[model samples]
Target: MGIDTFKEKCGYEIDEMWLPRVTAITSILNKPNLYRYFADSPNYPAAQRRLDSAAEWGTLTHEVVERMLKGEIVKPDAKIIPSIKAFQKWRENNIMRISDPEKDVERLVVDTKHMFAGTLDVVAEVNGTRGVIDLKTSTGIWEEHYLQTAAYLSAYNKTARLKEKCTTRWILRIDQYEECLGCKAKRRGKEGVLRVTGGKRICNHQWSEKKGVVEFKELEGYKEDIKAFLAAKELWEWYNKKFIRRIPNYAKN
Candidate 1:
């Protein structure tokens, strides 16, 4: 489903251009849960709390980093200090210059060609290359994330109305690292030593400010995936109409 927003001051609504978000179509929640190797011992309440923490950490980290990229120094909150520190450490080692960011490319102008819309996180030059950059805080870079980036790249290229085509798009991960107690027997000992892992980290969540740890990757197969994303959108539309969200007046106008 797509989210609808109206600007009170503008007086005119931008609704006809409404389309499902590139993110919703490529939603991580829709993916098949890959079974964790050593996570069969599930703590339901603890798991829920950790999930909540991850989501919170991700949002706070995004706010802090966005300000930092604009050359603003923000005092990190206790919750997201590790994540901000991790990104800062990476920037120190890497070359980055923010040209522009927080771009919204979801316009109705292309709804006829592409039936999707999305907001971009950033557009900047990193290590000499300039392209759209998306901040991700998920467990690991999933396939859906790749497609989501590709979709945003397509939308940005069109919305910006640039002469030269924008070729590259990136997904920058700003996630916290935590100690994993799952694989204690083999690596650590019978005494159970904790391993620093990205996804399985449970208690005392800390971001490792290791070089290249919190990093960016070119969105590979971006062009090819746009075709896949369009197909998925068509299917999503068909499903929604056939089962739910079929009311005409209540639907997006």
Candidate 2:
């Protein structure tokens, strides 16, 4: 897709909240010579194909972002053009700016060994304090979104070269564009809300690092739930690397 098309249609910007997982997964999946480990597995070919597709998608997405930020207009390929147009209309109506678009930032850091690391999309000063901002394209918000943001914060605390602490993290939801015809109703609707199809709110979140907490104002038990999620992610990673890697020929069954 064209970068301008994606940015204008999506109507949101990337943030630090997405860095941790993206960084971690990208690092693991893109690790130098790491695919060799899967060479003997039955799923190697399919896995490699999937990985290749993912890499292409990642590269395309990055290119789109760069083009958009540079104020260049991009033309999407035929397959994605219709959707892109629809998204453009939706974003034009509901686009919300979470921070100043004019800021100089550094690149994101991704680390694999620590089971956490990734580059954040945007890090800027919010009200005189540094904060992380993430952009997401989804039909609706998921609970894990908060955990993902928190994980990014944790990673930033560990590896960001900046001397200042990232005291805030945010998730900005860019609703998918929905198009319908033959009715008096609006032809296009919000993407994020369209996913829920209910009265649920789809907006942005600001997580405070100093408080040592992340909050989802819409959900009552958000804080406790996030803590549990982080713990589970840690355990799952450990099991996959330390335990699952040791299993022999179990996949052949």
lDDT by residue (tens digit), candidate 1, 1-253: 2322312211122354345655656653356543332252256554455555556666777778787776677998764566677788888888876644333221222333464566667766678776777887654677777777777677667755564336788888865544334432111111122224334334444433322237677877876788787777666666556432533322232
Runs of candidate 1 with Cα error greater than 4 angstroms are 1-15, 28-30, 34-48, 101-112, 163-165, 178-212, 242-253
Clashes of 2: 9
Model 2 C-alpha lDDT per residue in residues 39-138, reported as the tens digit of each score? 5235776557645643454344444443444455987544334434443553355433334343322235433334434456655554455656554433
Q: What TM-score, over all chains together, does every model reach?
A: 0.69, 0.43
Looking at candidate 2, what is the lDDT of residue 29?
26
CA lDDT scores, all candidates in order: 0.57, 0.42
Q: Deviation in angstroms for 217 in model 1? A: 1.3
lDDT of 1 at 79: 49
User: Which TM-score value belongs to model 2?
Assistant: 0.43
How many clashing residue pairs appear in each of the predictions shown? 0, 9
Highest lDDT: which candidate? Answer: 1
